[model samples]
Target: MRAFACPHCSSLVHFENSVCLNCGSEISYSRPDRAFVLTSTGRQCANLERAGCNWLVTGDGELCDCCALTRTRPADDDADGLAAFALTEAAKRRLLFQIDDLDLPLAGRREDPVGGLAFDLLSSAHEQVVTGHESGIVTLDLAEGDAGHREQMRVQLAEPYRTLLGHLRHETGHWYWEVLVDRAARNEGFRALFGDERASYADAVERHYSSEPPAGWADAYVSAYATMHPWEDWAETFAHYLHVRDTSQTASAFGISVHGPALESEPEESEKDFDALIETWLPLTAALNAVNRSMGLDDLYPFVLAPAVLDKLRFVHDLVVARPAYVPAG
Candidate 1:
């Protein structure tokens, strides 16, 4: 996440900041200008107070661009669900910010109902809410917003890491799979790297839980979960790629320098080249894990990226950089 400054007082602010601590001026993020602006300059999102949104909007309905992506949200009367909704929306706003920063294509369902993106932020307290992506919509189980519940599921599923942001990133990956690969006419290229996505998805899910990932799976896959199926592999890899990109940018923005051996190139140079970025990322993550260990916390990044995983990451990198050229078919 990039750092922002309060336009009022020139005090350094953050992406999530809504008010200038130094000047006491209300601020909102203007996505179009990619800068902080006073709400007086433009209307704040309708969900600003309800969902804690700090985005500015300009006449495309009351909701800002990010808030507009939400198709289903907890009702006003559902107190617990609404609380969860706030947390999930915050994570999603961060995800969309990263996606926008990366120059990925982002079209709302209204823009192209057939293949455009939308979100259903639902609570699972009363019913089982499966989190996944389908037909351009990402369904999120808002109950995951509870840290205790999220950690419990992480342990139960034997996942090394899990978070609302990670969930949003992974599901959004499926949306991109359509926009950048399938709809963009790059299926052949995708199949070459990730395997045949046409394989039976239901059967793959059944087999994944019934059997252990093959030995030496880490050498090729970023996570054990990636071994489930080609589509999952792509999403997992995509999420991992987002993890690297966003963390690296935040570190750089905050001047959190790592004594990583691969810091020779400028950040822009790394942005243009996959191997170049990894060169910095690998050592940076090592340094991060070292700090975490010193503080007695789990490693910040618990997974390793082998050569095969690097190949998949490079594919995602290329796709993201070229996203402007892809247009969803109506």
Candidate 2:
């Protein structure tokens, strides 16, 4: 994420800040300007009363673009569910910000009822909610917002790292499959890189759960879960791409640099170049892991990027950069 400052006091502020701490100014994000503005007159999102969403309403509706994408949410009266919903919405805002930064197209169900993006933040306390994406809608179990619950599931699933933001990034990868990859021009290349997504998804799920991933799975896939299906493989790889880009951007904003004779290459400002991104990422992660170790914490990034995984990442990078220009149908 880019550094944000209070428009009034020029003091550093966070994206989630509604009231600037430095100058006691109210702040709301402006979608068109892509920055937080001091707002006394601008209307706040309708969700502000319930969800504490601070994004400004850009049009006739009271909901902001991010809040409008939420088609279903937990009951307002359910205290626990409402708490979880707030955290989930915060992560959703971060994900949407990154997508906007990448210039990715975002259309909601109202725009394309058949295959536009939408979200269902459900509470598993009442119903058994499985987190996954269907068509263009992504469902997330609000229980995942609880850090303890998330950690328990992470251990059960044998995942190295898992979080609300990671879930959003991974699931959106599925939504983008329809938006970016299913077209005629990209299908052949996508199939070659990620394998045939037409392969039986049901069978793959059964096999993946009934048994263990094949030996050396890491050599070919980003995670064992990714070995379940080509669709998952694409999503896992795409999530990693977003992870790298966002973390790298943060590092650049902080003026963090790795300087040594061993690393002679000069750093660049933009992360669009995959090689440059990977170059900055490896050394940065190494240092990060060391820092975590000193603090008696788990490695910040526990997985390694194999050569095959790198190739898949490159494919995703090229796809995003070369995304076709959107042309609305008449």
Candidate with the greatest TM-score versus the true structure: 1
Q: lDDT of each model, Cα atoms only?
A: 0.87, 0.86
lDDT of candidate 2 at residue 3, scale 0 to 100? 76
For residue 14, model 2's alpha carbon misses the true position, in angstroms, by 0.9
Cα lDDT tens digits, model 2, 1-330, are: 777888899998888999899899999887777889977757889887687788998878879999999999987689999999999999999999888878877788888787888999999999999999998889999999999999999999999999999999999999787677884257888989889999999999999999999999999899999999999999999999999888777776667766411222222334557786788788988988989999999999999999999999999888787646542222
Number of backbone-clashing residue pairs for each candidate, in the order shown: 0, 0
Lowest-scoring 10 consecutive residues by lDDT in candidate 2? Answer: 260-269
What is the model-wide C-alpha lDDT for candidate 2? 0.86
In candidate 1, the residue pairs with backbone N, CA or C atoms under 3 Å apart (3 or more residues apart, or in different chains) clash, namely none
How far off is residue 123 in model 2, in Å?
0.8
List the pairs of residues colliding in candidate 2. none
Off by over 4 Å in 1: 260-267
